[model samples]
Target: MDEYDFLGDVAVAGSVDSFDRAITPFLSQAFHAKSLLAIHFHRTRLPKVLFRWIPDKTLRQLFDKRYEKLGFMVDPFFHRAFLVQDWEACLLRDIAPDRFESSEYFTNYFGDTNMVDELGFVARIDNDTAVHLSMGRNQGQRRFRTNDVVRFGQFAKILAPKLRQILINQPADDVVEAQPLDRRFHAMAQARHTNISIREAEVAALIVQGHSSRAIGLKLGISGLTVKVHRRTLYKKLSISSQNELFGLLVNYVGADA
Candidate 1:
């Protein structure tokens, strides 16, 4: 199908619910991607998924059930979409932080996906919102090459502008208005004991997302020792002894919200 037909189907689908059936299959074949996930980002509220397709059942289940709630915080592609402020296809390994493969988030949540690589399109609608078109290579598929990324980038020059306009005109569901993650994170942690501070809650959020103490410190602009102190304190406050327990608590928290 041509670009217009592809986008026409997307627009006619109305809301994001139909996106999987409308655009995912076409894009997958066009890009030779094993999985595709289209997400609409809200600057403050939770993002809305426009479309999702994964060939692997276990990986798809993990993405739907846990990624948005926990693993997303550590996702470089997701974070970069906000920072890039432009349309481009980005490779995951090129942008991933040092020691990322060794991090708990990757070892646990991300590792479970069995995906070999990812390339994402950041379609910035404005300062407040953006749409992400992410395509991935699963374990058995070949990795995206430099030339392929270049082609995708060239394609973005066409795809992004059209998509931005389509999104503006079609206007999928409004982004939910809600408190920032840190505040809400703190509130949830305090359900058992209201001793978690806002900063500690921030630390907890990153921790659950699979950041190491050192990485968390770097991102938060503090020393490794400070991160350790905060980690210890929050662990005591939440009555959790290990990262596994903390993850379980947050998983339950997200499930409750659902």
Candidate 2:
């Protein structure tokens, strides 16, 4: 009957490693299971541990002998799995006669799975990355129960927003190509001379979306203080202070067609 809430901690875990450590104790408490494992990624190569449930005595031996020794390239799948763009990529494949398995990923990473039955959400972290989570009960009486699955599913939802932030809210890397603005956001920035960086434009659009500094920070994988700084800079660049004044200042540029 543990009643601890892992929602806040998981959100604060940020990166994969941090998330792994943060969720360990929480998972232990919530699921009351013997073992757990969490794999996180940042592209197609950097598959790092987010957390794990290793009950074996020789953890090193298990990793070295099983994954590396077997030559299974788990890293590729871990790093490349993104939910939004690759919704059709996640699948389930049993490794041992309906025992252990994974949520198989698609060429692009998003997809469905036969691994566990539960509710979940997927989101794009960037143009090339995403993440996913699903919860299910172990039918075996000695292992887990339906209540455990229900509890974990609730916990997982708490992390969804944070996961979205981690995967999607990152500051735009100059290396990645900027996404073409959608009609609304595009119209808002129509007169930015088409030379503004995507990061700047995204911030501008968020501002128009009526997102507060703190809200934008959570959505974009940045600190609220950083959002404030960006807002100030944006004001200076656009020659306005109040968001109320923004539409008027940029109306000439964005509303020109109208």
Candidate 3:
């Protein structure tokens, strides 16, 4: 494909089928993405499936039904999407925390996807609305390169605004706020140790969700050093020596629900 050939067809894509025909070549040729999933997100409700394709049936069910139903509580990507409503392409590794790969969210659910890497392209619709296109690479496929992200991001920038418009013109669905994810930490900690402060629990939750102290601080309006202080205090209160222990406790406490 020439430099201008990729995503050029999207300009005439008026429907999802047309869009797929236009983008499939670029995805397979440029990024080698094995799966492409588009999700609509707003507030606390489960992410609405705009369009999704996963080759394996079990993997698709695990992600769409099971993960969205239960596993989202600990998903770093889900939390980050709502927190920032970032409208750009980002690598999953860059968004996830220092120890996210070790958490149950990674080991149990995300692991099932069998993806070597994930690249996300988000389109901001409004203050609390956005759409995310999640692209994945399987074990045999090459990971997305820098040029892939750059080119896809440029295409998404032109295409995302249309998603915004489509959403605006559509009738709004009823939205019910789900349980606040922050409280899960407090609930889990109090089951064993009652001394954990709310702030400490919040930090612990973010930590287990793969956030760095700096990322947690930015989310909580505190300094990174303060987050570290809270980490030490929380660890002490929970009688834990490391993040691995903390992740273990949360996984145990959150259990089948997660």
User: lDDT of each structure?
Assistant: 0.74, 0.45, 0.72
TM-score of each: 0.79, 0.39, 0.75
Which structure is stronger by TM-score: 1 or 2? 1
Candidate 1's TM-score: 0.79
What are the runs in model 2 whose C-alpha is more than 4 Å off? Answer: 1-5, 11-18, 42-46, 58-60, 64-124, 132-145, 167-258
Write candidate 3's Cα lDDT for 1-258 as tens digits.
Answer: 654664567676666556656666566556677778777776566667767767777678777765555466675556566656546778888777776887656776667777778887666777777777778887777777888788778777766765556666667777655555557678876677566788897898788787788889998999999999999998888888887788777667656455
Candidate 1 lDDT by residue in tens digits, 14-74? 4455655666777788779888887777677677777688777998998887766645656
Task: RMSD for all candidates, in order, please.
Answer: 3.7, 18.7, 3.9
| Error at 174, model 3, angstroms | 3.0
Model 2, position 120: C-alpha lDDT score: 30
TM-score, ranked from best to worst = 1, 3, 2
Lowest-sum lDDT 10-residue window in model 1: 11-20
Per-residue error for 39 in candidate 3, Å, reads: 1.2
Q: For model 2, what is the alpha-carbon lDDT of residue 115?
A: 17
Local error of candidate 3 at 242, Å? 5.4
